[model samples]
Target: MFGRTKEPPAAAQPAEPSAAQPGQGKGRPTPTRAEREAANRRPLVPTDRRAASASSKEALRAERRRVQQGRINGEEKYLALRDRGPVKRFVRDVVDSRRNLGEYFLPFVLVLLLVQLAVSSSGNNVLFLASYALLYVGLIAVVVDSLLLRRKVRRLVAAKFGDEALFRTGVVGYAVMRALQLRRSRIPKPQVTRGQKVA
Candidate 1:
Protein backbone atom coordinates (compact mmCIF):
# COMPACT_ATOMS: atom_id res chain seq x y z
CA MET A 1 0.00 0.00 0.00
CA PHE A 2 1.28 3.53 -0.84
CA GLY A 3 1.33 6.39 1.75
CA ARG A 4 -2.37 7.39 0.92
CA THR A 5 -5.11 6.22 3.41
CA LYS A 6 -8.14 4.42 1.87
CA GLU A 7 -11.25 6.68 1.65
CA PRO A 8 -14.61 5.43 3.00
CA PRO A 9 -17.17 4.17 0.38
CA ALA A 10 -20.15 6.53 -0.31
CA ALA A 11 -23.59 5.41 0.98
CA ALA A 12 -26.28 4.59 -1.59
CA GLN A 13 -28.92 7.37 -1.82
CA PRO A 14 -32.63 6.51 -2.09
CA ALA A 15 -34.21 8.01 -5.21
CA GLU A 16 -37.32 10.05 -4.43
CA PRO A 17 -40.32 8.74 -6.33
CA SER A 18 -41.90 10.94 -9.02
CA ALA A 19 -44.99 12.97 -8.14
CA ALA A 20 -48.00 10.76 -7.52
CA GLN A 21 -49.71 9.55 -10.66
CA PRO A 22 -53.37 10.59 -11.33
CA GLY A 23 -54.84 7.98 -9.00
CA GLN A 24 -51.75 6.62 -7.25
CA GLY A 25 -51.04 9.00 -4.37
CA LYS A 26 -54.42 10.52 -3.62
CA GLY A 27 -54.85 8.28 -0.62
CA ARG A 28 -57.33 10.31 1.39
CA PRO A 29 -58.89 13.69 0.74
CA THR A 30 -57.55 16.52 2.78
CA PRO A 31 -59.37 16.95 6.11
CA THR A 32 -61.54 20.08 6.53
CA ARG A 33 -60.46 22.93 8.81
CA ALA A 34 -63.10 21.99 11.36
CA GLU A 35 -62.01 18.36 11.25
CA ARG A 36 -58.45 19.36 11.85
CA GLU A 37 -59.43 21.62 14.73
CA ALA A 38 -61.52 18.92 16.29
CA ALA A 39 -58.75 16.41 15.86
CA ASN A 40 -56.36 18.72 17.67
CA ARG A 41 -58.72 19.29 20.59
CA ARG A 42 -58.69 17.14 23.72
CA PRO A 43 -62.29 16.90 24.87
CA LEU A 44 -62.85 17.78 28.51
CA VAL A 45 -64.41 14.71 30.05
CA PRO A 46 -65.86 16.24 33.19
CA THR A 47 -65.06 14.15 36.28
CA ASP A 48 -67.36 16.05 38.62
CA ARG A 49 -70.66 14.23 39.00
CA ARG A 50 -72.90 17.29 39.20
CA ALA A 51 -71.13 19.02 36.32
CA ALA A 52 -71.28 15.92 34.16
CA SER A 53 -74.92 15.31 35.00
CA ALA A 54 -75.90 18.89 34.18
CA SER A 55 -74.01 18.80 30.90
CA SER A 56 -75.62 15.51 29.96
CA LYS A 57 -79.11 16.68 30.86
CA GLU A 58 -78.77 19.94 28.95
CA ALA A 59 -77.45 18.10 25.92
CA LEU A 60 -80.31 15.63 26.04
CA ARG A 61 -82.95 18.32 26.40
CA ALA A 62 -81.49 20.38 23.57
CA GLU A 63 -81.34 17.35 21.28
CA ARG A 64 -84.85 16.26 22.22
CA ARG A 65 -86.19 19.72 21.43
CA ARG A 66 -84.33 19.78 18.14
CA VAL A 67 -85.74 16.40 17.13
CA GLN A 68 -89.23 17.37 18.26
CA GLN A 69 -89.03 20.45 16.05
CA GLY A 70 -87.97 18.21 13.15
CA ARG A 71 -84.68 20.10 12.88
CA ILE A 72 -82.61 16.92 13.17
CA ASN A 73 -81.71 14.34 10.53
CA GLY A 74 -82.54 10.68 10.94
CA GLU A 75 -78.83 9.90 10.92
CA GLU A 76 -77.94 12.52 13.51
CA LYS A 77 -76.12 11.18 16.57
CA TYR A 78 -78.74 12.51 19.00
CA LEU A 79 -81.89 11.84 17.00
CA ALA A 80 -84.56 9.90 18.87
CA LEU A 81 -85.35 6.49 17.45
CA ARG A 82 -88.99 7.49 17.06
CA ASP A 83 -88.12 10.55 14.96
CA ARG A 84 -86.01 8.62 12.47
CA GLY A 85 -87.92 8.78 9.19
CA PRO A 86 -90.32 10.23 6.68
CA VAL A 87 -92.83 7.75 8.04
CA LYS A 88 -93.27 9.84 11.17
CA ARG A 89 -93.46 12.95 9.06
CA PHE A 90 -96.16 11.38 6.95
CA VAL A 91 -97.99 10.35 10.08
CA ARG A 92 -97.76 13.87 11.46
CA ASP A 93 -99.04 15.35 8.23
CA VAL A 94 -102.00 13.00 8.21
CA VAL A 95 -102.86 13.74 11.82
CA ASP A 96 -102.41 17.49 11.44
CA SER A 97 -104.48 17.64 8.28
CA ARG A 98 -107.54 16.07 9.82
CA ARG A 99 -110.07 17.40 12.33
CA ASN A 100 -109.63 15.60 15.61
CA LEU A 101 -111.87 15.95 18.64
CA GLY A 102 -108.96 14.72 20.70
CA GLU A 103 -106.99 17.89 20.01
CA TYR A 104 -109.23 19.89 22.39
CA PHE A 105 -108.83 17.43 25.25
CA LEU A 106 -105.94 19.22 26.92
CA PRO A 107 -107.61 22.63 26.91
CA PHE A 108 -110.79 21.02 28.15
CA VAL A 109 -108.91 19.34 30.93
CA LEU A 110 -107.38 22.66 31.93
CA VAL A 111 -110.82 24.21 32.11
CA LEU A 112 -112.08 21.27 34.13
CA LEU A 113 -109.17 21.70 36.53
CA LEU A 114 -110.08 25.34 37.11
CA VAL A 115 -113.70 24.34 37.55
CA GLN A 116 -112.70 21.73 40.11
CA LEU A 117 -110.74 24.32 42.05
CA ALA A 118 -113.80 26.55 42.09
CA VAL A 119 -116.08 23.68 43.11
CA SER A 120 -113.70 22.68 45.92
CA SER A 121 -113.84 26.19 47.35
CA SER A 122 -117.63 26.26 47.07
CA GLY A 123 -118.18 22.80 48.68
CA ASN A 124 -121.27 22.39 46.45
CA ASN A 125 -122.13 18.70 46.02
CA VAL A 126 -124.58 19.10 43.11
CA LEU A 127 -122.23 21.40 41.21
CA PHE A 128 -119.31 19.04 41.81
CA LEU A 129 -121.33 16.10 40.50
CA ALA A 130 -122.27 18.03 37.34
CA SER A 131 -118.66 19.09 36.72
CA TYR A 132 -117.38 15.54 37.29
CA ALA A 133 -120.06 14.21 34.88
CA LEU A 134 -118.94 16.70 32.25
CA LEU A 135 -115.26 15.73 32.73
CA TYR A 136 -116.11 12.06 32.36
CA VAL A 137 -118.08 12.67 29.20
CA GLY A 138 -115.27 14.72 27.74
CA LEU A 139 -112.72 12.04 28.57
CA ILE A 140 -114.90 9.36 26.99
CA ALA A 141 -115.31 11.44 23.86
CA VAL A 142 -111.58 12.00 23.58
CA VAL A 143 -110.93 8.28 24.01
CA VAL A 144 -113.47 7.35 21.35
CA ASP A 145 -111.96 9.90 19.00
CA SER A 146 -108.50 8.48 19.63
CA LEU A 147 -109.68 4.97 18.80
CA LEU A 148 -111.30 6.09 15.56
CA LEU A 149 -108.20 8.03 14.57
CA ARG A 150 -106.07 5.01 15.33
CA ARG A 151 -108.05 2.90 12.87
CA LYS A 152 -108.01 5.64 10.25
CA VAL A 153 -104.27 6.16 10.67
CA ARG A 154 -103.65 2.46 10.17
CA ARG A 155 -105.69 2.53 6.99
CA LEU A 156 -103.98 5.60 5.67
CA VAL A 157 -100.50 4.46 6.56
CA ALA A 158 -101.30 1.20 4.78
CA ALA A 159 -102.46 3.08 1.71
CA LYS A 160 -99.39 5.29 1.66
CA PHE A 161 -96.67 2.87 2.74
CA GLY A 162 -98.35 -0.31 1.48
CA ASP A 163 -98.67 -2.13 4.79
CA GLU A 164 -101.06 -1.72 7.69
CA ALA A 165 -98.21 -2.72 9.97
CA LEU A 166 -96.12 0.09 8.57
CA PHE A 167 -97.72 2.05 11.42
CA ARG A 168 -97.33 -0.82 13.85
CA THR A 169 -94.51 0.79 15.85
CA GLY A 170 -96.73 2.47 18.46
CA VAL A 171 -97.61 5.02 15.79
CA VAL A 172 -101.29 4.79 16.59
CA GLY A 173 -100.57 5.66 20.20
CA TYR A 174 -98.17 8.39 19.20
CA ALA A 175 -100.81 9.83 16.92
CA VAL A 176 -103.23 9.72 19.79
CA MET A 177 -100.86 11.61 22.08
CA ARG A 178 -100.04 14.14 19.40
CA ALA A 179 -103.72 14.65 18.71
CA LEU A 180 -104.33 15.30 22.38
CA GLN A 181 -101.63 17.96 22.62
CA LEU A 182 -102.59 21.61 22.50
CA ARG A 183 -102.19 22.71 18.86
CA ARG A 184 -100.01 25.71 19.61
CA SER A 185 -97.80 23.61 21.87
CA ARG A 186 -97.24 20.90 19.29
CA ILE A 187 -93.68 20.64 18.04
CA PRO A 188 -92.69 20.80 14.37
CA LYS A 189 -95.60 23.23 14.37
CA PRO A 190 -98.62 22.19 12.34
CA GLN A 191 -98.30 22.85 8.61
CA VAL A 192 -101.92 22.13 7.85
CA THR A 193 -104.93 23.87 9.38
CA ARG A 194 -108.01 22.23 10.86
CA GLY A 195 -110.47 20.78 8.28
CA GLN A 196 -107.78 20.88 5.61
CA LYS A 197 -108.17 17.91 3.25
CA VAL A 198 -104.97 15.92 2.94
CA ALA A 199 -104.01 15.23 -0.64
Candidate 2:
Protein backbone atom coordinates (compact mmCIF):
# COMPACT_ATOMS: atom_id res chain seq x y z
CA MET A 1 0.00 0.00 0.00
CA PHE A 2 1.28 3.45 -0.91
CA GLY A 3 1.25 5.91 2.15
CA ARG A 4 -0.01 9.45 1.46
CA THR A 5 2.88 11.92 1.47
CA LYS A 6 2.88 14.13 4.61
CA GLU A 7 1.45 17.59 3.96
CA PRO A 8 3.98 20.38 4.14
CA PRO A 9 4.21 21.85 7.66
CA ALA A 10 1.75 24.73 8.02
CA ALA A 11 3.21 28.21 8.77
CA ALA A 12 2.42 29.66 12.21
CA GLN A 13 -0.52 32.05 11.94
CA PRO A 14 -1.34 35.23 13.95
CA ALA A 15 -4.38 35.02 16.28
CA GLU A 16 -7.60 35.91 14.48
CA PRO A 17 -10.38 38.14 15.71
CA SER A 18 -13.52 36.38 16.92
CA ALA A 19 -16.44 36.11 14.51
CA ALA A 20 -18.69 38.05 16.95
CA GLN A 21 -16.73 41.26 16.24
CA PRO A 22 -15.40 40.59 12.74
CA GLY A 23 -15.86 44.20 11.54
CA GLN A 24 -12.49 45.09 13.11
CA GLY A 25 -9.21 44.65 11.20
CA LYS A 26 -5.78 44.06 12.78
CA GLY A 27 -6.98 45.24 16.20
CA ARG A 28 -5.69 44.00 19.55
CA PRO A 29 -7.71 41.25 21.19
CA THR A 30 -9.45 41.65 24.57
CA PRO A 31 -6.93 41.14 27.35
CA THR A 32 -6.90 38.07 29.59
CA ARG A 33 -7.19 38.51 33.41
CA ALA A 34 -3.38 38.36 33.86
CA GLU A 35 -2.82 40.90 31.11
CA ARG A 36 -5.45 43.29 32.52
CA GLU A 37 -3.94 43.05 36.01
CA ALA A 38 -0.43 43.66 34.70
CA ALA A 39 -1.65 46.68 32.74
CA ASN A 40 -3.27 48.21 35.88
CA ARG A 41 -0.35 47.53 38.24
CA ARG A 42 1.99 50.36 39.27
CA PRO A 43 5.37 50.51 41.04
CA LEU A 44 5.42 51.83 44.59
CA VAL A 45 9.15 52.48 44.39
CA PRO A 46 9.98 55.71 42.60
CA THR A 47 11.90 55.66 39.35
CA ASP A 48 13.96 58.65 40.55
CA ARG A 49 16.11 57.36 43.42
CA ARG A 50 17.13 60.71 44.94
CA ALA A 51 13.63 62.10 44.81
CA ALA A 52 12.30 59.01 46.58
CA SER A 53 14.88 59.28 49.35
CA ALA A 54 14.14 62.98 49.95
CA SER A 55 10.38 62.46 50.02
CA SER A 56 10.70 59.52 52.45
CA LYS A 57 12.83 61.58 54.83
CA GLU A 58 10.39 64.48 54.79
CA ALA A 59 7.46 62.13 55.34
CA LEU A 60 9.18 60.51 58.35
CA ARG A 61 9.94 63.90 59.89
CA ALA A 62 6.36 65.09 59.42
CA GLU A 63 5.00 61.92 61.01
CA ARG A 64 7.30 62.33 64.00
CA ARG A 65 6.13 65.91 64.50
CA ARG A 66 2.51 64.80 64.31
CA VAL A 67 3.09 62.15 66.97
CA GLN A 68 4.81 64.69 69.24
CA GLN A 69 1.91 67.10 68.90
CA GLY A 70 -0.51 64.30 69.66
CA ARG A 71 1.31 63.56 72.90
CA ILE A 72 1.40 67.26 73.80
CA ASN A 73 -2.33 67.57 73.20
CA GLY A 74 -3.07 64.72 75.68
CA GLU A 75 -4.72 62.53 73.10
CA GLU A 76 -5.87 59.35 74.85
CA LYS A 77 -3.66 56.78 73.17
CA TYR A 78 -0.62 59.05 73.14
CA LEU A 79 -1.03 60.33 76.72
CA ALA A 80 1.11 59.17 79.61
CA LEU A 81 -0.53 57.15 82.38
CA ARG A 82 -0.52 60.20 84.69
CA ASP A 83 -2.29 62.30 82.02
CA ARG A 84 -5.14 59.93 81.21
CA GLY A 85 -8.83 59.85 82.15
CA PRO A 86 -11.62 62.30 82.95
CA VAL A 87 -10.29 62.49 86.51
CA LYS A 88 -7.09 64.14 85.31
CA ARG A 89 -9.09 66.36 83.00
CA PHE A 90 -11.16 67.58 85.93
CA VAL A 91 -8.06 68.09 88.04
CA ARG A 92 -6.46 70.16 85.30
CA ASP A 93 -9.62 72.23 85.04
CA VAL A 94 -9.74 72.92 88.79
CA VAL A 95 -6.07 73.85 88.93
CA ASP A 96 -6.36 75.99 85.82
CA SER A 97 -9.48 77.77 87.12
CA ARG A 98 -7.94 78.92 90.41
CA ARG A 99 -4.92 81.03 91.31
CA ASN A 100 -2.24 79.41 93.46
CA LEU A 101 0.57 81.11 95.40
CA GLY A 102 2.77 78.06 94.76
CA GLU A 103 3.24 79.24 91.19
CA TYR A 104 5.26 82.25 92.47
CA PHE A 105 7.28 80.25 95.00
CA LEU A 106 10.36 79.72 92.83
CA PRO A 107 10.73 83.32 91.66
CA PHE A 108 10.01 84.61 95.16
CA VAL A 109 12.67 82.34 96.63
CA LEU A 110 15.15 83.48 94.00
CA VAL A 111 14.53 87.08 94.94
CA LEU A 112 14.99 86.33 98.65
CA LEU A 113 18.22 84.47 97.97
CA LEU A 114 19.61 87.52 96.19
CA VAL A 115 18.49 89.75 99.04
CA GLN A 116 20.15 87.42 101.56
CA LEU A 117 23.42 87.57 99.59
CA ALA A 118 23.36 91.37 99.49
CA VAL A 119 22.36 91.66 103.16
CA SER A 120 25.11 89.27 104.30
CA SER A 121 27.69 91.31 102.39
CA SER A 122 26.48 94.54 104.07
CA GLY A 123 26.14 92.83 107.54
CA ASN A 124 22.69 94.26 108.18
CA ASN A 125 21.20 92.07 110.92
CA VAL A 126 17.79 93.75 110.93
CA LEU A 127 17.41 93.54 107.11
CA PHE A 128 18.52 89.89 107.13
CA LEU A 129 15.98 88.99 109.83
CA ALA A 130 13.21 90.71 107.92
CA SER A 131 14.10 88.94 104.72
CA TYR A 132 14.30 85.57 106.43
CA ALA A 133 10.91 86.06 108.08
CA LEU A 134 9.36 87.15 104.81
CA LEU A 135 10.79 84.15 102.96
CA TYR A 136 9.52 81.75 105.63
CA VAL A 137 6.08 83.32 105.46
CA GLY A 138 6.05 83.02 101.66
CA LEU A 139 7.07 79.39 101.87
CA ILE A 140 4.39 78.70 104.47
CA ALA A 141 1.80 80.42 102.30
CA VAL A 142 2.77 78.41 99.26
CA VAL A 143 2.59 75.14 101.17
CA VAL A 144 -0.80 76.01 102.61
CA ASP A 145 -2.11 77.01 99.21
CA SER A 146 -0.95 73.77 97.64
CA LEU A 147 -2.52 71.69 100.42
CA LEU A 148 -5.82 73.54 100.13
CA LEU A 149 -5.77 73.16 96.36
CA ARG A 150 -5.21 69.42 96.70
CA ARG A 151 -8.12 69.11 99.12
CA LYS A 152 -10.43 71.14 96.93
CA VAL A 153 -9.50 69.19 93.83
CA ARG A 154 -9.99 65.88 95.59
CA ARG A 155 -13.38 66.97 96.91
CA LEU A 156 -14.47 68.20 93.51
CA VAL A 157 -13.34 64.97 91.90
CA ALA A 158 -15.21 62.88 94.46
CA ALA A 159 -18.34 65.00 94.23
CA LYS A 160 -18.36 65.02 90.46
CA PHE A 161 -17.05 61.51 89.91
CA GLY A 162 -17.58 59.29 93.04
CA ASP A 163 -16.18 58.34 96.46
CA GLU A 164 -14.20 55.66 94.61
CA ALA A 165 -12.33 58.47 92.86
CA LEU A 166 -11.21 60.21 96.07
CA PHE A 167 -8.26 58.12 97.17
CA ARG A 168 -5.06 56.38 96.02
CA THR A 169 -4.84 57.75 92.49
CA GLY A 170 -2.14 60.42 93.18
CA VAL A 171 -4.56 62.96 91.75
CA VAL A 172 -3.86 65.31 94.64
CA GLY A 173 -0.15 65.05 93.96
CA TYR A 174 -0.70 65.69 90.28
CA ALA A 175 -2.74 68.79 91.05
CA VAL A 176 -0.10 70.07 93.45
CA MET A 177 2.61 69.66 90.82
CA ARG A 178 0.56 71.39 88.17
CA ALA A 179 -0.25 74.17 90.63
CA LEU A 180 3.47 74.87 91.09
CA GLN A 181 4.17 75.08 87.36
CA LEU A 182 3.88 78.44 85.59
CA ARG A 183 0.49 78.68 83.96
CA ARG A 184 1.89 78.78 80.44
CA SER A 185 4.29 75.90 81.06
CA ARG A 186 1.85 73.27 82.33
CA ILE A 187 1.80 70.20 80.13
CA PRO A 188 -1.22 69.59 77.93
CA LYS A 189 -1.46 73.36 78.15
CA PRO A 190 -4.35 74.66 80.32
CA GLN A 191 -7.68 74.19 78.61
CA VAL A 192 -9.47 76.38 81.13
CA THR A 193 -8.32 79.96 81.62
CA ARG A 194 -7.84 81.56 85.06
CA GLY A 195 -11.01 82.62 86.90
CA GLN A 196 -13.13 80.42 84.63
CA LYS A 197 -15.51 78.04 86.42
CA VAL A 198 -14.42 74.40 86.33
CA ALA A 199 -16.97 72.52 84.27
lDDT of 2 at 169: 68
Residue-level error in angstroms, candidate 1, position 124: 2.1
User: For residues 1-199, what per-residue lDDT tens digits would candidate 1 score against the true structure?
Assistant: 8799998998989999987668666689999999999999875765687988998899999977776545423343444667446667677777888778887877787898898889989998888888889989998998888888989888887887768456456677778888887776766567677777765
lDDT (0 to 1) per candidate: 0.76, 0.87
Determine which window of 10 residues in candidate 1 has minimal summed lDDT.
Answer: 70-79
Cα misplacement distance, residue 2 of candidate 2 (Å): 36
Model 2, 132-195: lDDT tens digits are 9999999899989988997798789888988787675678899999999988777778888889
| lDDT at position 17, candidate 2 | 72
Over 4 Å off in model 2, which ranges? 1-60
Clashes of each: 0, 0
Clashing residue pairs, candidate 1?
none
* Deviation (Å) of 189 in candidate 1: 1.9
Q: What would the TM-scores of all predictions be?
A: 0.59, 0.69
